[model samples]
Target: DAGVTQSPTHLIKTRGQQVTLRCSPKSGHDTVSWYQQALGQGPQFIFQYYEEEERQRGNFPDRFSGHQFPNYSSELNVNALLLGDSALYLCASSDLGTGGWAYGYTFGSGTRLTVV
Candidate 1:
């Protein structure tokens, strides 16, 4: 039973560039959510995906998008990145029916994106 996994643990991109972060959900998990955490700030929800559809979204702009695969894996895509986008992008997985209360969510180590 592997936990959520994210790729490119660290990344650096110029302003206006685009980046894609990937995640694989933990076994038995069916929902995937993305979050952004800036320095000294708590994680901000980006969006969540389930059944290969966008189930819910946060206050992020349209530039922040995501997709969920049939296998329950997911990807977060950021376009026209800004310096403010520099942060730790975390992926969390949970079962839809669990309401994320009993077992809680499993989070990835996150991808550190630095926009210069």
Candidate 2:
């Protein structure tokens, strides 16, 4: 895991683009979390990987997996890429080891994935 490192700060139009992202926990953080932000909505929690294993998950399919931190990138797989999947995917990291995981989260930029 190299943390959440998003590329193409702009938008990535998709006509069948590889809908897979990457992420990892921060250096001191042991929990890697992922989020999905639609065009006009707040980021939604997808899942979290802690201790190299998935610990918690949200109302998302198996495709949404990864972490977000100052620098991170996880993998979110959307088998059936839908137009609704087109949104900003973000990665975040938290210090779950110190019991301050949900409170303090560091988020990196976002990768705008457009499904067309």
lDDT scores of the candidates, listed in order? 0.93, 0.67
Stretches of candidate 2 above 4 Å error?
Answer: 1-4, 8-18, 63-73
Best by lDDT: 1
Off by over 4 Å in 1: 100-102
> Which window of ten consecutive residues has the lowest lDDT sum in model 2?
64-73
Give the top-scoring candidate (TM-score): 1
Which digits, one per residue and each the tens of the lDDT, describe model 2 over residues 24-96? 5456665667788997799998878765567788998754544333333355566557777888888787777
For every model shown, what is its TM-score relative to the native structure?
A: 0.95, 0.75
In model 1, residue pairs whose N, Cα or C atoms come closer than 3 Å (at least 3 residues apart or on different chains), thus clashing, are none
> What is the overall TM-score of model 2 with all chains considered together?
0.75
Write the residue-wise lDDT of candidate 1 on 13-112 in tens digits. 9999999999999999999989999999999999999999998899999999998899999999999999999999999999987775257888999999
